[model samples]
Target: MGEWRRCCDNAVCGDNAVCWKSDGVKLKLQGENIQPANENEDLKKGCYNYGVDIADAIVPEWKELWVQVEPEAECIWFGEQEASKKPNGWWSFTFRNYLGKSVIRIKLADGREVVTDPIEVVSPKTPLDEQCDPLFYPKFLRTLIDDLIRYLVSLPFDWEAPTEFATEERTQPPSPIFVLHVLAQHADTICYALQTIWRNPHRRLVTEERWVLLSEASSVDADTILMMLHYPEHLRPYRGNSLSTLAQRLKSKVPERVFERRVTETLDTPENRFIKRFMDIVLYWCDELKRLGYWEKAKSHQPKLEDLQNFVRFLRADPLFADVSELTIFPASSQVLQKRDGYRECLQIYRLLHIARAPIFDRLQDAIDNRRIDQLYEFWCFFRLAETLAAVLGDGQRPYFSTLESDEGGLRRDLSANLGNGYQLVYNEQFEPIWKPKARKKLSYSVPLRPDISLLQENRLLVVFDAKFRFDEKDIQPNQPLEDEMDKAQQEGEIERLAKHADICKMHTYRDALKCRASVILFPGTKGAFHCTNGTKKDNPCLLDIVQNNGLKGVGAVPFVPKPEK
Candidate 1:
């Protein structure tokens, strides 16, 4: 018998003893469907093994099976088999650094071929708390609201009563009724201020002329001769002749009638006065707000106030505002006020300020007092997660998040990113609604499986996270034999060893029912670390760890601790 014959059994060479047969042969691959490992590991350290099984029932001669892997882009396979040996119908191979799906191909000695189902490799990236700071989200939101408030407060409120109307002449007697026209006056001020803010600097060329008497005549114009004759007594003698005849005696002898003319020029505008006054008013308002303790009362608002102050300074330094006249008060009329765009904008700003201030103030105060942080907490988590995804994916692959109301009246939010590949990542999607048994009598009701966060690739759920807002420490003791403890604890009535067990159990339920590769409970902790645990163990019920086997199921906890005060 050849070496190939030594590897044959009754299973491979049953009826055809002379020829190798491949009739009832099939290839099978087996491994834990779910593989859990750190993302930073390289191919060699991260790779796992899958057993290859060849089932041949009726061949007497040795048969060979050649194995291959398909779609070589995502992964590389090692230990490719061309085995004639049965060896209990199994062999093993390793796959390294693989994600997504790969198919296994088997070729028999008799030129027949078979293929196995696409093997899925699941690798979930670990989430870091530092990437999504809990405090930054709320602070960012508050700053936006505060900026709106500051802008609203900066609008001019005082209006100048129109003392004279453009339609009425100066000769026309002042309106005997003395109408105030408050709206028009206010509108005009707003229009003027906005125009001043937005308009370019005004400039004009100015020329000034002056004349001076000189001892010599540089160039004699008609005016120079007239001046010399009119002031004759002031002239001195030239070339030994009387000053009166010097003009006739000498052509250009230090001519007693000399003239000097200078034309001076400048560029000037009225905008500088306006800009200075406007800056003064802005500074005054800032000082008043500070003096009144508005920013101090809500310290979180100080950053916005400082930003507004800096913007005011920027406006003050702008050359465009240099020529605008300082407007102590605004003048307006009913017709002019309606026609001006700036007036309309100012009115809109005023309305917006009035509408936004009260609600935002109340909401912010509630957040600071911790009276309404529950809703804020949920929002913060959602915002942070979305931001983190966008940061990681970059502009080309940034995801968008949207909130929808489910039929059951619960809000559902999802973040979706298209990788441009065949796959996509959809996070925070709720499971389909279903009706399950609630009582022994077979009564059932709709139950929606809503995880706080879920990551899905194509149709497969990669992982799920539940945000829990409570301490997860359990009171159970480890290493104590249950029999001894049961007797001692029962006599002492100490049966509360399962504290906080429900949290881990709930996580397990999510993992099993959702059919996700892993489920994690995100809770608040001091150290911001990840702990994994298995639900089957009775001891250390709250302990969390990573478990990847039999389809990659795991239950774990990670902390999203709050930022400390500076």
Candidate 2:
């Protein structure tokens, strides 16, 4: 064992075994037994405690070892008196006051050096905390676009496709203008539909009055005679004011005069009403995009905006809609805008409007750029898993997965599969047990168990997976036997030895509390579908095989990498 340890220190750990600083006395590294950072715990920004342990290295009373931080950054280190504590060393340094990724390196007095795995500094959940590397922007946009496209594809036929943009083309290594193009195309379709409805508006006959010229040839009614007498020039043919001649002349001669007459009128139809309503919505979106600062970012879509303006102009110019004025206030209910012939297109347009109006869209760019990376990662996980499961079940046997629902907070999905046999598979996010056992002294309450993805068969949990946005391919390494012993020792110390990977600890909690067959932690990485499993049984837990086992138990971590471009 010493020889192995020596070999490991020579090759891997350098001159001394290096471990992460856990507390005042404990230093943990290279074992599953080491507890991971607590999820519920919060660490203040700036200076915090950090320490490291050196294995089998003799320290003579007082000596200092050099520690290096990569990317060539300087770190403040504690003095020799602090390092003299034989097996372990303590240090204090202020961390960078930002959230992102960094690495730490340690150099021993004997000239051997070891590098720690990448460490992620995460910030508390806030709108301003979403700073990320610029390189990830393109990938994030692609994922968001794919999710949206899938959502559109999943919609029922009644809500026709809002854009001519193909999902495949839009999702291909998205450009800065990609989102703009998508929104533009959607707006263009809506505008075209509206223009079609506006060209030939529905008309109805309405009774109205018009002035008509009456002549002597026209039948002389008593009203006409009185009207003609009021204007004497209308009876100019009769020169004398003799009663008998005037009476005789009145029967024979009368000049032309104007009088009000009833006639049918053509007015704008009900379809115009819907078109007008939709036009207002379009204009509002254009204004809102500008207000939300999307207009500047999406400048490439200026042509689309011009097209919308032209559509609005066309709607306003048509004589049928001459009286159709801008609605000062929109109806609380969309039902007021009745659907007609092109109602499907109108409905689709309304749907787009509804989406644009959502607050998520207002902060969509910010989310894609920073805050929603983890959420997008989770969404991608769900999408990939659902697709994989559907493929395994065959086209006819594909499970029905619900649309991803995202709020200001986060994302969720529901999925179910009926194999026609007695067996069934169901998946849900944030599932809660209907019944919870009551406590003798306190009120019973239900706690919601939210797993990123959960698989079940006939009301039995098969597997639960959590999506972790952090990149750590090394953490996925299988558990070592040395870890078991370390864990036992830690347990005797009255300190629980949780999984060194926080995500794994979370999975462990879900498995024990839910009593599910297995739980897995999923991470986003370049590694292609790596799976590590732990269980007492012989059968390995994969997506397809979990349903057959009666008492399957295990926990694992899988890396979900994007499929390579062909």
- Candidate 2 residue-wise lDDT, 114-188, digit = tens: 443443323222111122421232333344444533432332211112443211111122222223433465766
Q: For residue 313, what is the lDDT in candidate 2? A: 63
Candidate 2 residue pairs that clash: none
The segments of candidate 2 whose C-alpha lies over 4 angstroms from its true place after superposition are 1-200, 210-257, 269-271, 277-340, 343-352, 355-366, 369-371, 397-428, 434-446, 457-460, 477-500, 526-553, 564-566
TM-score of 2: 0.49
Candidate 1, residue 169: CA error in Å? 45
Worst 10 residues of 2 by lDDT: 44-53
lDDT of 1: 0.39
